[model samples]
Target: FEAGLLETLAPLAGVAVEARVASAPAEKTRKARFDEAMLFTHRGLSGPAILQISSYWREGEPIVAAMAPDHDVFEVLKAAKAANGRQAVHTALSQIVPRRLAENLCAREGVAGNLADLSDKALRRLDQAVNAWTVKPVGSEGYRTAEVTLGGIDTAALDQQTLAVKSVPGLYFIGEAVDVTGWLGGYNFQWAWSSGWAAGQVC
Candidate 1:
């Protein structure tokens, strides 16, 4: 049995092939835990916003993205007033998000206390915070569970027209495998389509 095993392995022993393995260095891979909430200012997600921001994510940095719209607190207050008509604007805003979040936001805007006590100035502040609520995301789930990887093959190594590797011929990469990643909405899909189309046309 030993002779037969050696005989079978003889052919494999002579085979030589180069194996390329890529891994993040220990320092680059080490993860730091962060406890903070990430916030977005717009009305929930408008599709591509999250994706665009994530495309620029860097390792080791605590992820917190925010946007403040031009309109201030008064806008939110007025809108709330219109929606609720006679109902309290703060009460109306509270119904949209968690009661606790609403309360905190209102408090930060000095619109807390009793709804009856809300002044025009306080209402304005509430409106601004809501419309431009400084989102604080309590960190992301980390790279292990991330949906899309941000960086990869540098674009400088690929031909913009054909997406062919400058150094390697008949070798092409596209989609998430490549460096270019689209925004969360349909941007990624568009990148897939474009990159795939380029490679298909060339290769």
Candidate 2:
């Protein structure tokens, strides 16, 4: 929010960023949505991962994010230290994530000096920072920017084969009107097509 550097851009556009989404609070591990663009908005966060979780985002809830979910940053750093102890720690880290991110994380974590000199404990802390960065938002962007609506006529009230309301002979809820919603990568469109075709058969 301060720098305004990473706003509404793709994940691969510049500095590499791993976006993890945790819709549930009691869950052990957050659902990781990697390689997606995450934006910092006036309210909180908006992007593919944020939007996908927003469909399930409840009020007074928070979404957990991990910057690097793919690998164990601590192990990677330790391995680098064993192999090339003379090299700068940040330099070794740059190979894992984006260089800019590696540098910033290294500085923030106070991970300086030759890897051989750094303790295993310090490396573990840095690993948590890189892979377990969590954020809590006030709320989602809502209907104005939501990708798809999550609810409509209840599934129990409709005929699954034809998508016709049980009580109503002619009424049909197809496409976005039904309760089906999906993730960021064009699943809702597929739902719309299938539901429309289903209703078309009955109509």
Candidate 3:
């Protein structure tokens, strides 16, 4: 990291700094690997939707797994409507999700009957339920297994131009310790680059 322009600007900006010695690594601790699979009734896992929601994690939180009957039933309904144009959508959906989920959704919507007996009104209601199924997350595995943490130091305390603390000169915070957190993809790495560059310029 170069320190030409940054050193010149540090004093001019009226900033204070602090430098602390980096700590040594701690003794090795036993770690367990968890391999719990996410399960869903209708649409199978391994898609973007499931992957995106998996990123959220916190300390001591249980690992959350989700299941919904809506999509499965919805697909069945859509298939019925297009195939015979007379089959009950809800009945078809039952074959897709678990029996309990199917029964619960039907009972909640007051839909009853075989494929040939469902009315237009019943079909519409069932259709709506399937498309927007709601699921409750049982829990999520705590931070020990989490990929990332959401919050950090307040970036407002540091000067954006030099990555130095306004109250503490020479002191710089970078990487995940900073207030910045990234979305699922490459965005986080970009933040690291930009922040490190700023700090390196001055450090």
> How many clashes in each structure?
15, 0, 13
**Residue-by-residue lDDT tens digits, candidate 1, 1-203:** 13443343233332221111111223544322221222322222212343334444344333232222333446555566655556655566655444544555665555655444456777766655544433323344567646567777888998898988999998887888888764455777889898999999977
Indicate whether candidate 2 or candidate 3 has the larger TM-score.
2
Stronger candidate by TM-score (1 vs 3) = 3
Best by lDDT: 2
Q: Which stretches of candidate 2 lie over 4 Å from their true place?
A: 1-14, 18-21, 27-50
Q: Considering every candidate listed, which one attains the maximal TM-score?
A: 2
> What do the candidate models score in CA lDDT, each in turn?
0.51, 0.71, 0.51
Q: Which regions of candidate 1 are displaced past 4 Å? A: 1-52, 56-89, 92-101, 107-110, 113-116, 136-138, 200-203
Q: At residue 89, what lDDT does model 3 achieve?
A: 44
Task: Please give the distance, in angstroms, between residue 176's alpha carbon in candidate 1 and its true position after superposition.
Answer: 2.1
By descending TM-score, how would the candidates be arranged?
2, 3, 1
Candidate 2 lDDT over 33-144, as tens digits, reads: 4356555444456677667776666666556666667788899998999999998888888877777667767776788888889999988977886767655555555677
- Give the lowest summed-lDDT range of ten residues in model 3: 15-24
What would the TM-scores of all predictions be? Answer: 0.51, 0.72, 0.51
lDDT of 1: 0.51
